[model samples]
Target: MNFPTKLKKLREEKKLKQQDVADKLGIARTTYASYEQGKREPDHATLVKIADFFGVSLDFLLRDENEDFQDKIFEDEAKRILKDPKTFLAARDGEITPEILDAALEIITEQLKEGRKKKSD
Candidate 1:
């Protein structure tokens, strides 16, 4: 949710050790650990370097996931569901349950994130 959490998550997702990332970024492992531990923050340049290393925008590191970008994902998903005749009719007839909808959205979001990560890789 926050920068430190995101940083640790990104590293874990890449299957890299903290030391590996620190070495790649030319920083001491302890310094990188401090960043991930939320005991310290990186300066702007280092933040940019981290973003570049992860192939993500600074905005992704700095902003909350539940912001506009998340809203856009939901909006786009809703539009897609509306455009599909089967889903549209199901929704109109109240055939789709809320649990089903939530599960669908969660799967879609995960798939989208994976696709984006693959693209970056």
Candidate 2:
């Protein structure tokens, strides 16, 4: 299914109205409805919000029909990784080996600063 269809399906499966999702994405209900109706498209930032809200990956959200299964796989694996006992212990202890911690931090920083056009000092 395409983005509009998939988006509507996801929202319906979650038992949410367009306004409910719009509130979560911090956009207007009309805008969200347009997205579902395929009359308008969301930008990368909004797309990120939608994917995050639905717990799917960008690749899965934008990819063709063949890759649908990866959505659940990635979503489940991410949740598992976050809630794993080792991850919990690492958070509690404030360490998970210096290298691993640094890598994780870098990934988070990159994601949070995705639209950067220039480097900061």
Candidate 3:
């Protein structure tokens, strides 16, 4: 996602009102709204503040908005499934359906992101 859309999403994901972020950034509500609307961009310092406030790296917040990023998992996460009896059976045979695998992947992804966030903090 682009900066504008991502900014809006991050705010919503945090359940923060625009004014809440504005207050935190010490900026006007209108200015923050403009950033989300793509009408204005935050300067370098403000951008860094936004990144810090959201607990995300500046690169993560400013990458190409149009880039298509597919879901990725760590090699260890894949190995984890292979080592688990439930998944080992499925991997060796056809015991586990694709739905189960997908659900496992999603759960693992959430766990990994949470772990990284906590470690960063």
Candidate 4:
């Protein structure tokens, strides 16, 4: 896909509107819309900012035929999470509360139980 298409997809995946991205990038909504429509391209600095905001690499944003970019991006994110488990956990709800941790553990335990029951059946 082209840069504009990729940008639009990424922004949508993050549940952000054009205005949200524009505000984050400190640009106008019209400018961001132009980017999504391929009417205008952001400069190198803005490209870097966009990529950083999306937690993706510059190549992922620019390359048309780079099909493995998604895998690479996920792998990088996984490594980052593994490197700092607490930070990753905290990012889920914007803060690492004991209630959140307990809830996560409860969900995991329930899933394990369900899996075991399925296996037995």
Candidate 5:
């Protein structure tokens, strides 16, 4: 499943109307509907809010079920680390120290920001 599908499923599972979610998110119902329709992409901050609202990780919301799971997991994990660098920890194979992982996540976060900036430009 893709983002729109996942978002809609999550909302339905929670038994929420679009307006309820929109009110919580401080957005219009039409904007939330567009998101479920795959017509609009929320920014990074909004993505975080949505994930928090649904009690899900960013990776879960953004993951493409048909794609390679591990690859998406790592990417989403990077986003999660950005949100809480002090608490997040993960290792691919070799052991990684917390300080080193924090630094790496910072770099990834910067890259993600730059990528989004480029897209908007």
Candidate 6:
């Protein structure tokens, strides 16, 4: 996908609205919408802001590759969470409590167990 499409997809995946992205970038919602629609390109500074806001590399945002980006994306996400712990927590809307993490781990463990059983079978 192109940059605009990628941008839109990422924003949506993060459960963010266009206005939220515009507010973060200090741009008008219409301008941000234009960017998502591929009508206008963002300047370098705006590009940097977008990259940082999304916790992604500019290269990842601009590229169409499926390999090697996952690690960079994870690193960027970790950095972003470290940079703004409150926002990170807020983004989860209280859904990521310790109990949730524990439950998720339990689910993963069960899945692994099932995978191993299948392999043995």
Whole-model lDDT values for every prediction: 0.71, 0.69, 0.70, 0.73, 0.72, 0.74
Worst 10 residues of 4 by lDDT: 91-100
lDDT of 2 by residue, 9-121 (tens): 87886679999899999999999999999999999999998876775567767865854553443343344335474643543244233444454455557766874635452
In terms of lDDT, the poorest run of 10 residues in model 2 is 91-100
Candidate 6 error regions (>4 Å): 66-72, 75-121
Model 6, CA-based lDDT: 0.74
lDDT preference between candidates 2 and 5, better one: 5
Task: Give stretches of model 2 more than 4 Å off.
Answer: 66-121
In terms of lDDT, which candidate is stronger, 3 or 5? 5
Quote the lDDT for 97 in model 1.
38
lDDT string for model 6 (1-104, tens) is 67888889778867899999999899999999999999999999999999867766788888866665434455555544556657755654533434334544
The better-scoring model by lDDT among 4 and 6 is 6
Report the Cα lDDT for residue 2, model 3.
Answer: 82
| Candidate 2 TM-score to native | 0.58
lDDT of 1: 0.71
* C-alpha positional error of residue 65 in candidate 5 after TM-score superposition, expressed in Å: 1.1
Per-residue lDDT over 3-96 for candidate 4, one digit per residue giving the tens place of the 0 to 100 score: 9988998888667889989998999999999999999999999999898677566887898874654554554445444456665645433434
Scored by TM-score, the top model is 4
Candidate 5: which pairs clash?
A: none
Candidate 5's residue-wise lDDT over 1-121, tens digit each? 8999888877885678999889988899999999999999998988988886664578788877786543444455455456765445322223334544565577777989999999999
Highest lDDT: give the candidate number. Answer: 6
Give the CA lDDT, 0 to 100, for residue 31 in model 1: 100
Collision count of model 2: 0
> Which segments of model 5 are wrong by more than 4 Å?
66-121
Cα RMSD, model 1: 14.9
